[model samples]
Target: MNRSSCAIVYNGNLGSEKFLIQVRWLERTAREHGLHVQVIGNQELIPGIVDGSPVIKGRYEGQEPDFFLFWDKDIRLARHLEKMGFPLYNRASCIELCDDKIRTYEQLLNEGLRLPKTLIAPLIYETCEGIDERPYETIVQELGFPMVVKEAFGSFGEQVHLVRGWEELLPLVHRLKHRPHLFQELVKSSYGRDIRLQVVGDKVVAAMMRKSEHDFRANVTAGGRMAPYEPSEREREVAVTCARLLGADFAGVDLLFGEDGEPYVCEVNSNAHFKNIHDCTGVDVAARMLEHIMSKER
Candidate 1:
C-alpha cells in the first residue's frame, strides 16, 4: 500500500492556538490514514516567477507533494502552486471568493439565494483623499438604522460591526471608508444566533448552532456559545448548494434564520476552523477532510 503525501500550507504569522490545532489534527489523521504529511507556512514558501517560470522559493529540491491542503488566505501562493500542476483543495478562486464578503454575497445572490439586504461601498484607492457624504446618507436611507457593516476580507467575525444609528454609523463608515466594506440590513430575527454547517464534499457532516447573549455576531470567537444542531432538509440543501456553488471541496456555511424560521445564506468559509465544530459535535472534521483528499487523490 502506497501512502499518499500531502503538503499542508498555513500562514505562519497567524498561528494561533486554534489554527495550530487544526494542523496538528491533520497530521495525526494523515498518519492514521497511512499518509505522509508536511506542514509548510506561506511565509516559508515564496511563490514567484523565476527565469520566466513559476517557482516556490523555499520548496525542497525535487520535492513535490501529491496534493496541497491550503489553509491560508494567501491566494498568490495557492494560484502559483496550482499553475505548476499541483492539486489544491478548495482551489485558489474558491478561497478568494470566500475570503471576500462582497464577492461571496455576489455569487450567492446570482444564484438566487436568500440573503439580508446589502449595499457595497464604492472602491476608494489609498492614493485618493476620501469618499463624499452622499453615499453614507444613501446607505442610511436604504438599510435604515441598526445595520451590519463588514470589511470585505475578514474572519472570525472580527471585521463585522452592528451600527445602531447615525452617530455610530458615521464614525464607523469614516474609519472603514478607505477599506472594502458593505452595509447590510440587520437580520433582527437571527440576532445573536446563527447555524454553522460543516460540508465535506457533498455532505453536511457536522453542524452546530451558535448564539451570543450579548453580541449580534454569533461566531464563537465573538463570545458565542455552540450547541450540536440537526439541520432541516431545507437547511441541508441550502448549505450543500452554497458549497457546490462556490466550487469548494469543503466549507462552513452559516445560515441565518428569518422571522418564519426560513434560512438565509449568511457567509461561506472555505478554510473554516474545525476546532469549535469538533468540540461541539465530536466530529473529527480534520480526519474527514483528509479522507476526502485521499479519495480525490485516488
Candidate 2:
C-alpha cells in the first residue's frame, strides 16, 4: 500500500491553547513518520456565503484526501465525510454509536458487561409531562438519591452533575426537562478517581489514573490530575472490549470502580485527546496511532 496523505479535521475557530499544542504535535508526528498531514477546520474546507449558507457547488472543490483524522469538535461532520467515501480514522458508524452516552451504556449492558445501574429518559413530550406532573418524592424514591444526571451527549465533564438529595435533583431535572438525560448510580466508593485507557486497534497503548481532590468527576479537563497507573487485568479486558464493541479504531474508555470493587465502564470517546495520555505515560500515542493506520493500509 502506498503511504497515504492524512487530513486532520479540527475546529479551526477554536482558540484554545491546548488545541494548538495538539495540532502541532500531530503535525510533527505525521511529518516524522514520512506522511503528509494537513490540518484544516470544517468551515474552511466547506465554504459558506455571507448569510451562513454553504456554497454547495463551490465547497470541497478539491479532491478528498486519502485518509481523514477527525478530532472531537468536527465529529458532527463524520457522516458527511462518509458519504464522500473518505477513510476516517474512526468511521462514522463507530463515532455515532460511541458519542451517545445512553447508546454506549446500552451496548455495554447488552454485551453483559458490568456497568453502573443507569436509566435514560428520552426527549419526548409524554415523558416530560409525566415527570413534571408526578410528585418529586415519587421520582426520587424510584431512582434513589446520590445519583448522577448527565446529558445524553456531552464531553469534557461539562454536563455531568451529582445530586446528593432530592432538593438538588428536582430543580436540575426540571431545568433539563426539555433535553435528554440519563441517570447513573453514583460510584461513591471509587473516591472520585477513575482510570482512562487509550485503546488503538486491539491494544491498550496508554493508561492513566485521573483523580480529583474536591470533586466527583475525574476528567483531566475538569481540573483533575493525571498520574501513571496500570489497569488491572480485568480493567484492561473490559476497556478493550468496550472499544472493540464500539468499532472504534481508536478510543478512550473511562472506567470507574464501583462500590463492589469492580471496574465499570463510564463512557467511551471516539475522538479521544492523547496529550494527557502521552504526558502521563511518555508514550508516543499519536505516532503509534499513525503506525496503526499504516499497518492497516498494508
Candidate 3:
C-alpha cells in the first residue's frame, strides 16, 4: 500500500522545548498513521516572485506532500505554498486573520460571535510626528480603568497587557500606538482564569481550564496551571463555530467566562501549541489532527 505524505512546517528560529514538542508529536503521529512525514522550517522555504508568479526555493527530496501542516505564522511562506498548489491544513487566509487580533475580532463579530466590548487603536505610522492622547479619555470613559490591551500580533500572551487607571494606560498606549492594538473591557469575572477548547475539524477534541493566581492572563506560557475540563454544549458549540468561521481545519479557541458563566471569545489560535493540553488531558491532539487531515485527504 502507498502511504500518504505530509510536511510539517514550523518556525525556524524557535527552538524552545515547548514548540519542538508540538512538532515532534505531529511527526510521531503522522508516522503511526502510515504517512511519510517530512519536517520543515519556514525559513528553509525561500519564497520569491518572478514574472508575476509565485516561486519557492526549498528542500523537498521527493514529490510534494499531500498537504502542509503549517505551524508557523509566516504568512508569506504559507501563501506561496498555497499558490504552489499544496493544500495547507489551516490556509494562509485563516492564519492571517488569527495572527491579527483586530482582524480576528472583526471577522468573528461579523458572524455575530460574542466577545468583550473592544475599541481599536488608531494607526500611527513610523513617520508620524507625535503621539495623540485625544483618544485616551474616550477609551477610558468607554472601557473604563482596568482594561485589557493587546498587540494585534502576539502569542503565548506575552504581548497582552492589563492596565489600570489613566497613568498606566497612557504610557502603554504611547508605546504600542505605532503598532496595531485594541482595548477591551476587562472580564472581571473571568480574571486569572479561562477555558481552552481544542477543536479539530468541527468537533471539540480536548479542553482544559487554565488558572493563574499570580497573573491576570491564564495562558500556560504566562505561568498558568491547567486542569482537564469537560465543556458544556454551549461552550462546545461556541468553540466549534469559531473554528469553522475562521476557516481553520484545527484551532485552539480560548473562551472567557462572563458574570453568569457565559462564554465569550477570547481569541482563536490557528497554530495553537497543544503541549500543555496534552499533558493535562492526555488526549493526543496531534494524533487527532492527523486523523482529521487524513480523513479530509479521502
Winning model by TM-score = 1
TM-score attained by model 3: 0.96
Is candidate 1 or 3 superior in lDDT?
3
The TM-score measured for candidate 2 stands at 0.88
Better of 1 and 3 by TM-score: 1
Candidate order by TM-score, highest to lowest? 1, 3, 2
lDDT of 3 at 290: 88
Report clashes for each candidate as comma-separated counts: 0, 0, 0
The CA-based lDDT of model 2 is what? 0.79
* Models, CA RMSD each: 1.6, 3.9, 1.7
Candidate 3 per-residue C-alpha lDDT over 183-211 given as tens digits, one digit per residue, 9 for 90 to 100: 99999999999999999999999999999
Query: Which portions of model 2 show Cα errors greater than 4 Å?
Result: 1-3, 47-60, 73-76, 125-139
Write candidate 1's Cα lDDT for 45-114 as tens digits: 8777878988777655347888888989999889999998999997999999999999998888767578
| Residue 200 accuracy (lDDT) in model 1 | 94
Candidate 2, residues 184-294, lDDT tens digits: the string is: 778877757999999999988899999999889999888899999888888888889998988889888999887676788889998788888888899878888888887
Largest lDDT belongs to which candidate? 3
**Would you list the C-alpha lDDT of every candidate in the order shown?**
0.89, 0.79, 0.90
